[model samples]
Target: MNALAPNLIAFGRVLRRAGLPVGPAEALGAAEALGHVPFSDREAFRAALRATMVHRRDHFEVFDAAFDLFWRNPDLPIRPPDPDEQPPDTFPAATRRASEAMLGASQPRSSAGEPERRQDAALTVSDNELLQSLDFEAMSAEQLSEAKREIRRLVLPLSERPTRRFRSDTTGPRIDLRATLRGSMRLGGEIASIARRRQITRPPPLVLLCDVSGSMARYAQILLHFMHAVANDRARVHSFVFGTRLTNITRALRNRDPEVAFQAVSHILPDWSGGTRIGEALDRFNRLWARRVLGQGAVVLLITDGLDRSGAEGLSEAAERLSHSCRRLIWLNPLLRFAGFQPRAAGIRALLPHVHEHRQVHNLNSLRALVATLSADGRSHRRSA
Candidate 1:
């Protein structure tokens, strides 16, 4: 057991570098687990280490690749393969990343180290491109952390809506009678110059209604990071999470730090990762919050998978009311990521017609597309008016 300790510790470091959450504690746990299993049996050895080191479903692939490369060639150093040596698409993203980490550990230092570093940097850029399209449900702990950082930089630029109030403008289309008269009075009633004004325009309020049911657990967590960023970036942003019941989390998410805001949310939320009751939750929001937050032509973002537990009862009416109350009601469903997805579920059929736009919220690319859609919608509204 003492002889294998150094090898196990090095393997743990490779897993960590490959973006698994393995640490010294997990390494110790693996060592203890291996004691019970026969070391000579390769399959048993792999199983024991896996049980101790891997916790997340998404980490399994990377862990397996790292384990194979490290244990099979214990003494041999593996250098990164040249990009042209093999087609990049032949390897899975997890395998590719694991190979890179293992190579970084064993590659010998050379005088021409600058080129090697540049190649590693290029590989990193490639990894980020792949990450943008990766599903939130498939991301490992490290990837999810990186995704959160990317989410923070996302800007939700809503369309500017005209208000009844006016502001002074030099090239105004409409003359300001009140301001013109006031200015003439200052010139001894000579009517010297006409004052001008233009209608004031500002971004509309944003409302987020997220589902935190059992099936949507992973997506809800990632979307909350996005909601936190949006809430802090602008005013009049309201956020709510619902499962068996609705909870207003607008105030909780307003905290500057994302970690603190999520902690506050968890403390207040009682029905997270529970059963879904879309109809009842929407009804509650309509009665308790619609009048308060759905003012000033607000844009509503409803994030859910549309798997209702209550058989869609009263959901259509509630959705219709919500759509009418806001300037635009956008339904963001993760299920839409499937190419063959249909509104076969009762909840989806009930709510589909009520929404102005139905979009996917499963990946970072989808979220970026959403921002583009909103900006385009705002511009169209301005042109049409």
Candidate 2:
């Protein structure tokens, strides 16, 4: 038996506790692989252990975390974090707690104000990265709660559009003759620098049409929270929920408290978690609220699973009209999360041709990607498609 066999076994057990499936057989294999590699080469040792132990790509991060936790600086005593420092934001409750415990264990109370500190940047960094990559459907209750917190902090920075209004600017292309003369009055009516005016720019209005039907319940529920967060964070975010009927929840989501806002939404929307009527819902929107909210170059986010109870009747015409009304029509479908997903449904097929962009929105990562897509252009405005 190798002298380090016991240590390798212990490490494998630690990995199992950390959510990786490392058994005794895998531990034995890892120990054997390590024996062939130079023990002095840390990278070689890690690679050998990883190849034998980790079965999935997602397992790599957990294994790396475990390896770092167990093998880190044997000579140096662990130092606990200072009492004043706030705990870092991390995800997947288990990993977060473990990191905080480890960091806190590294130090003991000291009489001096200055406590020795060593930054565990990698652990904190990897924890967040891992959390983002995790599927929302696979998250535990605790992880889901954590993910919600991250979503609350999320921002939707949409591209700005030029307004008919103008603001006085020193570097503007158009000279303001009236303001220039007014400024010159201070210097004996001689124009020192030309006063200029530029067209005012503001973010395009964001209109979200979310599906809250039976097939889209989970994703739609999370997205409601997301929309509420965005609505409260910024102006011009119009939110609506649709099932068999269209219900505008823009005013409902305006409250400072999310729970209160959600309750308000529930009171207003009666057909949630029911059958979907995407075409009829879009038809209602076009007839009643389209001109009201879709003005000022709005970007429409049509969120749904595209499962229509009406078999997509008038879906194409309604979809095309909605697409034409909005600056950019993005269809965010949770169904797109599947690898082999196809637009086989009548509603999906009917709506696909009209949308400017079709993307997934099943998790925080996808939501973040939505923000990225909207904010891709640094310019204030891009011509609407």
Range of the 10 consecutive residues with the lowest summed lDDT in candidate 2: 376-385
Q: Model 1 lDDT vs. the true structure?
A: 0.85
Give candidate 2's whole-model lDDT. 0.78
Off by over 4 Å in 1: 1-125, 378-385
Candidate 2 residues lying further than 4 Å off, grouped into runs, are 1-127, 177-194, 378-385
The digit string of per-residue lDDT tens for model 2 on 265-305 reads 86687887788999999999999999999988898999998
Residue 74, model 2: lDDT of: 30
What TM-score, computed on C-alpha atoms, does each candidate reach? 0.69, 0.63
Please give the CA lDDT of all the candidate structures.
Answer: 0.85, 0.78
Alpha carbon lDDT at 68, candidate 1: 84
Clashing pairs in 2: 78-106, 79-106, 79-107, 80-106, 80-107
